[model samples]
Target: MATRLELALLSARGVGKGIRLLEYVGLVIVLAATLLAGGHEVWRMFSSGKVGISDLLLLFMYLEMVSMVETYWRMGKLPVRMPLYIAMVGIARHLMADSSYHDPWLMIAGAGAIVLLAVGVFIVRYGHLRFPYTQASEEATDRE
Candidate 1:
């Protein structure tokens, strides 16, 4: 026997809980996948008995992915720069892996992409420093 407002609030709370549960499930999947991929990469390197710069870069990207997931899980929100950092590493890995076969223009474009991602990371860092989100505000947003 709840009022319409009370019913709406209850529904909202339920939805919020559902969303949070889904987020956790997604995070777990991402973490597992990243770890599996990293392990596979390590096994390949060990079996081959050779490690190249590109392989190392790929491992670094995987590490960054894991770190990004951990940061998001701990902070309840993700920084905008984590994906940019991952993208930069991915592009660098691609460039290193395919430098010999890729056309010069494609290589230049990939390098440009890395630079743009770096700029994005810089801008996000500056924004965080210059106009940081207050904890109370963040908490309020998280509650919504």
Candidate 2:
């Protein structure tokens, strides 16, 4: 016979498992979609006989997204810097594709954003190396 507390705990664990399953499904779907889009873009470039900045950046974004997903799948954690990289590339892609956005101020702001993301990546890497996690610390965190 299980106590009410035990039953509640079991229910919570079931819910957690369900959520994790959904997350896995969603990630797989996203990965497949990104691959399809990248394939289509590459095909378009091949057919058109010209590769431009926007197409290259789009491929970079697709690659980065796949890398992020694979890292998450393997490590069970995604670095904060990954999305920062994606955003930087995304902004660059926009700048390359959109000709009407030729305002100097906008360009400066976009450059500033990329610089900030680079700083964030440096900070995260430094912090991770400087204050490395240990197995005991991880176990203690899990208990908490």
Candidate 3:
């Protein structure tokens, strides 16, 4: 026979496990979709007579997304810089693929976004290096 506190804890643990399972399932779906899209792009590039800059850029974005997901799956934690790097690459791709020489302002805005993401990556790196956590916290996290 368990006390009310014990029962509540058990319930909480069950819910936590359920949520984690759902997260893994979601990640698997994302991985599958990314892989399919990437494979399609590669096949199309091969089948077509020419591969344009935009096509390569789109493929690169897909690859970066897959990398981010794989890193998260392996590390059990996602780094703040991964998405920033992706965003920077995405912005660059957009600027190169969709820019018109007539509209300098649009190009400037995309370039600005790249710069902002770069700064964010720098900040995240500095914070992690400057305020490193103790081994105790690492051990506790591993137990979880």
- TM-score each candidate: 0.90, 0.88, 0.87
The 10 consecutive residues of candidate 1 with the worst lDDT sum are: 92-101
Predicted structure with the largest TM-score when compared to the true one: 1
lDDT of 2 by residue, 1-144 (tens): 999999999998998889778889988998999999999999999999999989999999999999999998887678888998999999988877887658988888888888998899999999989998899997897556
Worst 10 residues of 3 by lDDT: 93-102
lDDT of 1 by residue, 1-144 (tens): 899999999999999899989999999999999999999999999999999999999999899999999998997788888888888988888887875738988888888898988988998899989999998988898776
Residue pairs with colliding backbones in model 3 are none
- lDDT per model, in order? 0.90, 0.90, 0.85
Whichever of 2 and 3 has more lDDT, that candidate is: 2
Which parts of model 2 have CA positions greater than 4 angstroms off?
136-144
Off by over 4 Å in 3: 100-102, 135-144
- What's the residue-level lDDT of 34 in candidate 1? 96
Q: Arrange candidates by TM-score, highest first: which order?
A: 1, 2, 3
